[model samples]
Target: MRHLTLLGGLVLGLAVAGGAQPMTAAPATTPLSAIAALRDPAGQVIGTATFRQMGQGVQVSVEARGLPPGGHGMHVHEYGRCTPGVDPATNTVVPFGGAGGHFDPGMSRNHDDPQAPNKYGHGGDLPMLNVGADGVGRATFTSDKVSLTGMNGVLNRSLVIHANPDDYKSDPSGMSGARLRCGIISRNGLTTRDYPLPGAQDFPEGVAYDARKGVIYTGSAVNGTIYAVDAASGAVSKFQEGGALGRRAALGLKVDPQGRLWIAGGAQGTVSILSPDGVTLKVLQTPDSPNPYINDLTLAPDGNVYVTDSTRPVIFRVDPDLTLTRWLDLGDTPVKYGPGINLNGIAATPDGRYLLAIQLNTGELWRIDLRSKAVQRVMGGLERGDGLLLDGRTLYVSRNAMQVVSKVSLSADYGSGQVVAEEPLRGLRFPATLAAVGGDLVVTQSQLDKLQGGTPETPFRLTRFRKF
Candidate 1:
């Protein structure tokens, strides 16, 4: 990953070179001493941040009193909970680890280079907070893209301190370690912001549903346990567990028309087929010829399964005999490496005539005619296109970079495309998969590995959207 200095001088140069108006740095108004104190669950004033309105942005100076001596990743997460005390059994902190991912206003892209020309991370990642041997560290930075006033006007979110530094572009969540400390970010003399969803709902991370049976199947990427959820009541039941699959990290779930549930085991690079009753489990390994970082899978109308490999940039077609064949190799696409193309999600049209795949590294969505094996660009200029689903005449695509979902209409020529809908997802973070259940759109937020730092409240979210 490339690291560009986000300094005031660079901001001016880029603005001028790009023929844009230069941004003026706003003067600090609120006194640093006037800022109110923020405390953790133990009632300790861990840090204090002074907020000032800037030119179309906000500058926040943060100072911590008793932080560990070193540099730490800091961010204003979406939620405000600061539950303390680690769990003795698991050595994990409680609700503190459950503060869902960053605050993604657009719901399109992932947490990467926010300065990228095309797609970037949201306005949550702040400058690295450093602590000295005296256990106090102070840093001042400006967010020209976002402000505390726009953060729901509450300015009462939590400032999460990560165990490790952030690489920034690691999707789902930054590779940063656990949440060491959390403090509620509040305005001077203002009350704390009220977070609507306190503790997250512990639903399945990646789920695929059977619209007919109203049954939802989910799997853990860490434990590899398959769970069955009653779609109507949201009751969870463990269907399958440890056998020969090692630690089953179920990435994608789909049910064939014949009532077979297909599970994409990401860790093992294999597919597990379960009977309609969710009793029997069958495993199929990837052929030796291809890279097997199985990310997403979908069943074609012909009863064969199409799976995507994130690392190899190829789509594999699996037959009943467990024979794997190359369905499409997308290495030839013109994609920029940084914001260009890395295959992540795969979906096919209802008739199985067209197949769509999302490039994670870029916002490019490719449409492939299964019959001709010809690929065409459908949509571009997205933040990070992750999950894709086709419903009726509209195609629903999840942009992990922008933190929003966009809909594109298919043209008669099959090559041209038009935007139908693009709406900001109010409370979604790194949504990884999209599915259609009985004409309704269902989405899952993988939350990736963000749970390690925060608590395991409800990292996996299942949301239903009605098409207008």
Candidate 2:
């Protein structure tokens, strides 16, 4: 079995042009500090705002980029939530409108100046953020209206950036045209929430989510035990027993458009497609190989599922009709399958024209034309890329060993891309693969290294990064 204990150093390319990389997370020892990662409606994190305790008030510092050049209103909202919802006032959908209104717990009811007395203005009101032509903005000031631990504290609330400038005297949000970006305030600064699994021997790898049922599914690497978790309630239950239906190891998983679960059997050279109720619909196998390691799988627009085999340098395609075939043999191409995990995560373009895959051993990204079976190296420097999720033109790669997720913005033609951001999955043991749910990213803490070095952590878990 190819144990996922491979830890290779990463070499990332320069960041995307004109984009502001997210700030490094603050030290956990920092006292009374909170951070909010402001993200746009597209769910891309554009900037961050940090708050620190200073005497009786809170010192606020905000930095953001990739925004329009103008004066934009910034403020703290009543709720910590940032999901889109219909505004009660307009009865129309608005981005970050779920955050409710300004932080006026004192019932000030007036949207006065930031310099105004606390009793005369909303506590959430902040000075207008002036963005430069380069699409960057920075502001720092102290606010006496909000504390970190007192009755008026804004912990777990939300910080929002508005589309237009604030007039400083208008009532109810100062005519801030629209909520462009918003982030939840948290003491540890990170928005990842942990969901505990059943036992310690799991060493889970692949992760998938059923949006219709709000349930998350992960498979055990130790013995192929499939576990299902309720996304809303964080409840854990067994979806499938280990070694069921001859599945020895579950490496990668995906919920197809039909809600069926497609699982990759590591070292077994098998792929299992199970119905929503855990019944085995079909089990497909690849050709006999000496060292076949079925690593990951992805669904395409054309109703076909493409999978990767890390050892044999080949890809497998499972057609919608349940037929399985060796789709593309990389041994015939320039992508030499050498030692280590060769191909790990796989993603396909929405148009189903190309398939993007990563080389774990060499840190190279390749694009394969579906029609011609031609392969081209699109980008490199993703050595430990484990799981991939493509949203629009953005490709997110989970660097398991690095404990970070690299955000890559692809070119219009999927021929080129650049790493725009790398966010650390704080407190995660070893993030393997990831799945997107709404605006959040649900990741598997594989902890494979621990399985190799020592005892795995008790009660394995999954992590959810809010609006990642």
Candidate 3:
């Protein structure tokens, strides 16, 4: 009687300290959620877990089979790998050995009970998973110690299920046996054809992605903030806030060969050089004489940077030593929207001989000779060109106000081209810019037109356009 009473008291105290209250029915969660397949050592998926943002907390909906119709110790593990291996130190073969201990980013190592949300244990602890008679368990659990946003978030972490059930009070995994299931979390949004940028209300006009690092980056013009997404983990964090960028709007953004970010300073008469972590390195300022309204930028094969000016008639060039020079002068070229202002988008040839630029007034594609400064109209009637992306011989032109993207094929020389296809994006509010991230076309819905017209609602986003 005395032992049972003491045990009951200990459980109650632990539960109270950890704030272990009954979990309520899950309400609708924010769009910050990820799905991962629970797999065995044989690479066979046995279940799935979807982690979602629930208010200030997080909730994971788990569903699977192959259990023994009893309680199992299911937890978030430390490592993301799920392959079976031998622990090198001991050379002991284990099930899902690649998935290390419980996921405790801070290395708390205090494997406390998941129900008791106290500071006594590792944040990865979870409640005992109850499997039914049919060997399938379906349940939802919530936690306040971890979330899906900002640094050190739970994305990219692994979920693991033990062969035995948890004893609840034991430290360091509750004597749970070998890991039977393991899987790494992935953003539900990125796995689909269209990736959603939730809560982006500013004019999102720039996008940059590193396929190797699985990082997705975009910037907001109004707020002047840069946002980054860990494509592997679905964790979203602000890479840079606009205040550090002064009043200049981030328009066209591109990653250079040196892994630095070259940003177009719209109407700021400058180009900003940013570190890979979104820190401002230097500003390539223009001469105040012609009033450069630098809008978009691209790197040529010669390692020089070329930027188009929306107001001025010339394109600015940045040399290796940060020397700013006049690259090409369009001299009031007739364009689709009329003369005076032209050359909104620019791209350089891979061989470093010619440069392709679009005239905003005439919708004509012009190829400019790099050495002679000679310009010729290659293709005409490409209206409202705002942003241009070149893939092989293909050119993608973004018509900001029109919400349309035109894809065309250019000939070998700086001469002619044909329209391959067009994608309408105006339905996305007001898409203003684009970037190619891996196999998809990343489009930013700037909503600049609405802001210009005194629209009450302002919502911004980076919409992924996948090529079928």
Candidate 4:
């Protein structure tokens, strides 16, 4: 019998060719690394995985198609070949000769087992692949320990599917049954149809929620594309594609009390206000700056719009007359990147007496006293803080680094804070923005890479989380 090894403890056997059937060639000779696709004989893509470098670790996204509805186990295996059947007489199916054996570059063993814990196995063991009724499974995730540069490079190994779901801690096979499918990671980019639309190539630095219009607007970093998503149905539409603003890539989006959408074009140092109907109303140029790279903005209760320059660590107050005033200079915040303070997500208290800004690079959450302009760190060590929502005395923060959401109770002083909720929402992939409607939390899963079953590569996804 021919066998294949994969990430975790999965093993697969390929059926030998018989009669008119062609022999399953020794898994292709492609270099097993990078992002690649697995396709069926008919040239239909079955799945895809992308390997990325994050910090000192590796992040991979697997999306699959043409599977039974619901969840299925997925993992990287020890070997790359999938041979058919087994020799019952020996009671051993190829004995690791085919797939190899759990990828143990470190010679570690077992899953979450205290004996080995972090030592054994490669970073490819995954939970079941959840497919919708339409038989599509999509997911994005990261691993801090593995690399996908090449076979010996980390993913150069093999990938396999199991008959049963992985318990995540089982040794050998995790008690999961026979192997169902197998593939090898090749150096050349995997072939795949764009599943989910890739997120704006540049960072989606700022997001805004317009409750009355029930729409969300976000700015991209690369090309000038302003995304308008319907709050009711999560339908996304593009407005203003190829203009000066389009070329500049919008950054932050805010809604004025008068119900107009204001966008900061980071590339051009310009601000464009859009009507409720998604039409441009006016454009204002930022004064005293070249290439402002506007980061975050919020409308104050005092009827003025406050904008932050990500490149210079400065905040400007813009009046209705387009007059600009230097509100605060945050250059001394003990964190560098000056203008690029990596200052991204921003929000304000209902009373507008306090504003919250998240420093993405430093993972610091700062509360600014509007009156004194004093900035205090309310919390720090949050990963890739991207979105913020304030409801009553509670604050909701999205941590893209850890791929989770957290809720904290806010004190009048913005000091005594307590964590209220922190849980993973299933099927959430790279959540970048959030909106709350009538107690329900709406989140956007910008599936940023190809996974087992994501569509259009990195398509946008919406999920609802109910708060009790």
Question: For residues 1-468, could you state the per-residue lDDT of candidate 1 as single tens digits?
Answer: 122121111010001111224334223232211243556546676777776545345667777776678877777666656665453335676546545566554343567544432225655666677778998878887665444332222144567776567777775446666666676554342111111111233324456878778876766656666766665565667777634356457777788887888877664777778888766556777766544578788877877789987776567898876677776766675533343337767787777687777777766777778888777877775446777777755766776534456677777544656655543333344566766655455566555535544343243555554442
Give the candidate number with the greatest TM-score: 2
Q: Write the per-residue lDDT of candidate 3 for residues 161-212, one digit (tens) a residue.
A: 8878888667668877778788887654332233455554567777777676
Cα error, residue 246 of model 2, in Å, equals: 1.4
Q: Deviation in angstroms for 457 in model 3?
A: 6.1
Model 4 earns a TM-score of 0.58
How would you encode candidate 4's per-residue C-alpha lDDT over 302-330 as one tens digit per residue? 77788767676777777887676777888
Q: Least lDDT summed over 10 consecutive residues: which range in candidate 3?
A: 4-13
**TM-scores for all predictions:** 0.60, 0.62, 0.55, 0.58
Q: Rank the candidates by TM-score, best first.
A: 2, 1, 4, 3
Q: RMSDs, each prediction?
A: 12.4, 17.9, 19.6, 15.7
Question: Clash pairs of candidate 2?
Answer: none
Tell me model 3's lDDT, rounded to 2 decimals. 0.67
Better of 1 and 2 by lDDT: 2
Alpha-carbon error at 207 in model 1, in Å? 2.1
| Cα lDDT listed for each candidate | 0.59, 0.80, 0.67, 0.57
Q: What residue runs in model 2 are displaced by over 4 Å at the alpha carbon?
A: 1-187
